[model samples]
Target: MTTPQLLMIEDDQRLAQMVVEYLAQSGFAVTHAGDGAGGMAALERQLPDLVILDLMLPDADGLELCRRIRALPGAAGKVPVLMLTAKGDPMDRIIGLELGADDYLPKPFEPRELLARIRAVLRRRGEGGLAGGAEPARGLRFGSLEIDRDARTVTVAGQAAELTSYQFDLLVAMAERAGRVLTRDQIMEAVRGRELEAFDRSIDVHMGRIRAAIEADPKNPKRILTVRGVGYVFAKQQD
Candidate 1:
């Protein structure tokens, strides 16, 4: 297996150094950037398997930086972002997610947890050969909407739809079971590949993002229907 490259944008040099050294032991080659601009420059230098972003930087607000990263062109824009929120604030975490972060870890966390989270996020992007011996699933289609599993791309009327790594996996999980009304737990479990102890409200945010990307009218979504009191169902048939 090839070592996964990582870019960590953090102002704390000591923490960054420790993380770099620790992750190196786990076969990840890390590149560190002290601020948002340096981080963006490093990103332009080479795309890594994942980016570890700090919510508070000396030169930029991490939320604005996250927006900028999402605004980048092509695949660079789609690179998975894992945010580190220093405040341990839930609202900050939610805003980061709204701005397209794939995941978040609060400050003063265990290195082991960080490693696990990194591996989990990377796996969602189909990195690190996480699928093992299983055959890759084929693409799915519903009228103008096309989901290419291999490319990890989604298109609406041949136009690309922007989706974060986790959102893409969530969509694929539902698309794989069209017409079946899956509860929130089911949706989470499907995307996670295992059972979750509690429901994640973030899935609703992801679903909204998906609708905005693929539906003509997000307010009246036809492709992904919300069955109140139950869950959501991917329309088996679409225009």
Candidate 2:
């Protein structure tokens, strides 16, 4: 089996080197970037199997980087991402996860724990059996909104809606299980291959964005609805 290609984006030189060494030793083909620019550059040159991203980078923020990574075309869309940050705030973790990170690791972490997280992410993603391509054949329709699973495209009242790969994936996952209360953890598992961190409400943010694109009125959304103490549910269009 091929070693997993991993990109480590961290501004701290010592920590970056240590992570690179540890990951490499753990059977990952690792590349280290000291700044956001370099990290993005590395991504453009060749996409890795996974990315270990630091939240505070010199040139760009980690959340934006996660969005960019998920926006990449074709096979790159399915590559899992593990975010690293010193910030232990739940909000920060939620935002990172919302931006399409597969997992999050607080700073001053053990290499072993990070490795375990990475393994879990990979396993979850792999177990899904979701092959990269356009959308699948399954589709869910509600009023003007039609989600083509095979095409991986969404249409609002017949006009195609432009969505990032991550956004499209999130929509399809929720729509497929419409009406079922999917907790953030379950949604994370199905959509991004990970769980939400405490204070990480990024999922809510992304869902809001999705509502804006799909709902006639985001504030009074008719499609995606919140499930108190659980997660969110995609509502079927009312007759």
Candidate 3:
């Protein structure tokens, strides 16, 4: 089996070195870039399996860099991105996911947690094996909303909905279990093969993004219903 390659786009030299060593020890081949420009250059040379992007960079904004990365041609554009930010604001995490980041980790984090998040992102990308479970149906239809697992695409009312990879997965997770209410921890564990942390609203943010893509009225979502104090459930709609 080929080892996964990771590109770390961070300007903190000492921190970067420590991460590189730790991740390398954990069986990842990591490449370090000091800034967003350098990271882009490195990406041009060879697209890594996953990108560890730092929100703060000396040469460029991390959000813009993530946008550019997702705009790249071919598989490079589809590469999973795990964002690291010093800011502990929930809005930052939401914005990162909205910009196509597969996962977000606040700064001053433990290396073990970073490794776990990295593995989770890679698994969601279908690179770290099928740890989530058996493959879902090739196509799922609910009313006018269409989910094509084979193509990893979603369409609503015959119109293609633009969704990030993470959003798509979260939608499928709920859609697959239509009519069943799933707790936040249950959803996270099912989707990412992990548990949600205390006060972790990441799932809710991703749900909001998915609702915006598939729901007729995101503010009043009908497909994915919030179960208040429990979690959420995907409403089963008929054709």
Candidate 4:
């Protein structure tokens, strides 16, 4: 197994050191950046397999940093991000997801749990997230919209769509079950292979982002439809 390269952007030196040491034992190659500027410089220098971002950086807001990361040109933009937030407000976590974080861990968390979450996110990326014993297909298509399972790319009318690794997985999860109304809990379970925890509303946030990428008009989506109080459905016949 290849050692995964991870870039951790955090200002808390003591906590950063502890995490670096812990993850090293698990065979991860972690690079620590003490501030947003340093983190962006590191990321520009070398693209990592994943980024561990802190919600509050000394020089920049973590949410803004995440948005910048997504805007980066080429492959640097699409790296998976696992956000670390110390705030007690669930809004911070929700906003992190909205801004393209692949996952989030509350501070004061067990190192073991963080390790587990990291592995889960990476595994989902590698396996194409079709984890329920289903044979992997080549790809899925809907008219001008195409999802290439192998390349993990989505293109609308030949134009590449910007989707995070996690967002791509979420789209595939729904496309695999096209035309079916998926409840938020069902969507969460499909993507994460686990149910949401206590009133988690990140699903809506992510879906909105997904629509903005794939839909011609996000305000009036045709491919993915909201079903009133039910949930959402991927249109069976899309243009």
- Please name the candidate that would achieve the greatest TM-score relative to the true structure: 4
Q: List lDDT for all candidates, in order.
A: 0.83, 0.74, 0.82, 0.87
Give candidate 1's error at residue 67 in angstroms: 1.5
How does model 2 score by TM-score?
0.71
Per-residue error (Å), model 1, residue 135: 3.8
Whole-model lDDT, model 3: 0.82
Clashes of each: 0, 12, 0, 0
| Estimated TM-score for each candidate | 0.92, 0.71, 0.85, 0.93
Q: What is the lDDT for 68 in model 4? A: 89
List where candidate 3 sits over 4 angstroms from the true fold: 44-46, 74-77, 127-135, 157-159
- Per-residue lDDT of model 2, residues 1-239, tens digit only: 98888889899999988878888898988898998889888988988778889999988988988887877664333577889999989889777756667567898999888888787666544433233444545767877788776565688988766554456677877876778888877776666534434333656766876887788788988889988888899886542
Per-residue C-alpha lDDT of model 4 across residues 1-239, encoded as one tens digit per residue: 88999999999999999999999999999999999999999989988889999999889999999998987776532589999988979888888988889888889889988888888788778888765986867988999999999889999999988888888988999999999999887887777734324344777888898999999999999999999898999999987
Report how far off residue 125 is in candidate 3 (Å). Answer: 2.4
**lDDT (Cα, 0-100) at 59 in candidate 4:** 93
Most accurate candidate by lDDT: 4
For lDDT, candidate 2 versus 3, the one ahead is 3
Give the worst 10-residue stretch by lDDT in candidate 4.
Answer: 192-201
> Residue 202 deviation, candidate 1, in Å?
1.1
As a whole number from 0 to 100, the lDDT of residue 99 in candidate 2 is 65
All candidates: CA RMSD in angstroms?
2.4, 4.7, 2.8, 1.7
Query: Candidate 1 at residue 80, lDDT?
Result: 88
The weakest ten consecutive residues by lDDT in model 2 span: 124-133
For model 3, name the residue pairs that clash: none
Error of 1 at 119 (Å): 0.4
